[model samples]
Target: LVVLLVRLHLTGFFWGDCSLSNTLFRRSAGEFAAYLVDAETGELHGVLSYGQRAYDLDLLSTNVFGELLDLQAGELLDADVDPATLVARIGERYDDLWRALTDVEEFSVDEMWRIEQRIERLNRLGFDVDELDIVTDWDGATVRIQPKVVEAEHHARRLQGLTGLDVEESQARRLLNDLDAFAAAHGLQAEDPMIIAHRWVTDVYEPLRAMIPDPLRGIVEPAEMYHDILVHRWFLSERAGDEVDFFDAARSYVESILPARAATVSAAETSGPDELSAVSPSDDDPSFD
Candidate 1:
């Protein structure tokens, strides 16, 4: 959690309202990565002061604690989980992440490898720095550096670049990794990414989309359904050590998975004004004969 918060700060973002719901967790190369959502209310500060950073941290902790309590009330939390201990640990995690992203060191001018090293750290944290904000003394004897405009959640963009499929941030990351694997298997190059993605959509995505039953079409968006199918395919592939054919996978998904998803949209059409009040009773009184 600390690692994620510090990363966001380093990227010049202040998650104005942070909480577990705004974040999604996914496994990447055996470690969990956090993706921040609900950034509509967030602020982008040119530079974050220590006090400002601490306040953001405090809000994170408070929000997380409150969320956990709410979960417990709903009987969603594990009985063994301790709220106080968990909240404290979250703070500790934030501090550690902060240090990794910002701790500076002095190096001789002869050693220029530090610059590369800094970029590598951010890359490992799933970020690509578009521009670095660096400061040098009047003599140019020493360098001070920070990332000026870092692009966060790169996986989402890459996935869309390849597949033209927009997805939720975390799911996009998962799908992008799969696309890379698919590219490698087909001996595809960076220049040929779109071609490969098209092949994937034709050979994989479309078949799954076609399998959606007409009655249950409103369960989720098609792109999201496609994303989930890819996830399901990955798990199945890992279990069996064989690639599952897209159509077969789609059949299984539509049968077993799609049915379980509750449709949020109602089938009944709403009555328009013309339909609701189409006819009115006459107010004329009948004369007695």
Candidate 2:
């Protein structure tokens, strides 16, 4: 909720009636992402003043506090939930994120590497520093820098550009790491990035996606399933004292992990070992590593 509010404020949007009921949450990788659902009272401007942002935060606190209290009275609230603490923390989280995005930092002229460090920090936070404002003191002894224009989904955009996979930021980050490993493992690190990404998509990603049974498709998202399979592969590899084959790992995941989810698969159409083995790539497919 705080992240959604921060991004909306960044784009000069004022959500007048911010509340939990006005937002929707979805699983992004392992983390939850918030989206504004009812923007009926929202307004757009060239820029929002401090007072406008403050007003939105106030409304959030008020509406959420009342809602939580109502739930508590009805015995519907979680036992660990404290309406007061959660409401107070919302503003605190918002301020921390806003400052991290827009605050200016001053440093000695010799510490120019801080600029790259700052960009890396923002990227790690799933934001891109599109434009930065850097100023030097009159004496040239110190420099100040702030991000002027920032955007979110830094890793998602990069992953999409490379492989055309539109996924959540954290999932993209995980997939990109696997992509890098794919390139390195196959000795394609020196090849063109687009070409390498294409190879990874065809040999690594798409094959696993095709192996997912129709009945199991909706148990989790495709990208997240791929990530979980990678994690499962690591554990399987460790247990066997050797690297587990990717296809075998994926089959194991579909048969073992997916059934534990709420969805059930029909026995006749499930991707059993023989079905997956039939669709598995050839040994020479070049994604083995």
Candidate 3:
């Protein structure tokens, strides 16, 4: 919590409300990351005062307590757990998060590669630092820097750039990694990542998608389907002691795995796609019986 608060402060924003429930977790390059979601009440400030920061922490504790109580009521929390202690622990976690996001490093001017290193650090934390606010003093001897316009969900944009597919942040990160691996394994190199992503989709993703029978098509989203297919391929390769052909793995996935999942319902509570047509009047039928 402290870490996020520090980063937000460094970036010139005040999170008026901060709590566990207001954040979502995603895995970035094998590390867990927290993203702020309830920013509707947050304030953008040039700097946060000590009192303001404390108030945010207080709100966070209160919110955590309430969430724990609610979960207990719902029978989701362990009976032995103490909410007060848990709330305190949450603060520690936030502090660590804040440090990771805003900690600075000193590098000699000769080590210009540190700038790229910093960007890579932020990307692994699931952020894109759109602007780096760097200042060179009058002496032109010292450099001070902070990231401005830092935005969350970095992988989502990268996935869109590559595949024109927008997925949950974590899923996009996973898919992007797989795409890179696919490119390397095929000895393909091009500046356009999207071209490679397109080839993978058309050659690999779409064929697997088409294998789904119409009756079971709505069980999962296309991106999720593709993710599962990749997992299946890995397992198949491991079992056979050789790389499984993509098409063969896809066929096995569609036949064996996808059928057992529950059918995905439409947003309006309709039975299925055919449900609409079944209820509609036929063109030749008279309105009056």
- Count of steric clashes across candidates, in order: 2, 0, 6
- Tens-place lDDT per residue, model 1, 1-289, is 5567877787677887878889977433224567786888788988788887888899989999999999899876889998889999987887765665555655556666888888878666656778776667688778777765666556667777878876655666656666677778777766477798898777766766677777766555576666556666666677779998656666666665655442212221344434433332222311100
Residue-level lDDT of model 3, residues 127-161, one tens digit each, is: 88888866666776666666656776789898887
Model 1 global lDDT (CA atoms, 0 to 1): 0.68
Query: Model 3 lDDT vs. the true structure?
Result: 0.70
Tell me the whole-model lDDT of each prediction, alpha carbons only.
0.68, 0.85, 0.70
| Candidate with best TM-score | 2
31-59: candidate 2 lDDT, tens digit per residue:
66789999888999989999999999999
TM-score of each: 0.66, 0.81, 0.68
The TM-score-based order of candidates, best leading, equals 2, 3, 1
Off by over 4 Å in 2: 68-78, 216-220, 234-243, 259-289
Residue pairs whose backbone atoms clash in candidate 1: 2-93, 2-94
Stretches of candidate 3 exceeding 4 Å from the true structure = 1-54, 69-89, 137-141, 216-219, 263-289
The stretch of ten residues in a row with the least summed lDDT in candidate 2 is 260-269
At residue 18, candidate 1 shows an lDDT of 79
Off by over 4 Å in 1: 1-46, 105-117, 133-145, 189-191, 221-227, 234-243, 263-289
In the predicted model 2, the residue pairs found to clash are none
Say which prediction, candidate 1 or candidate 3, comes out ahead on TM-score.
Answer: 3
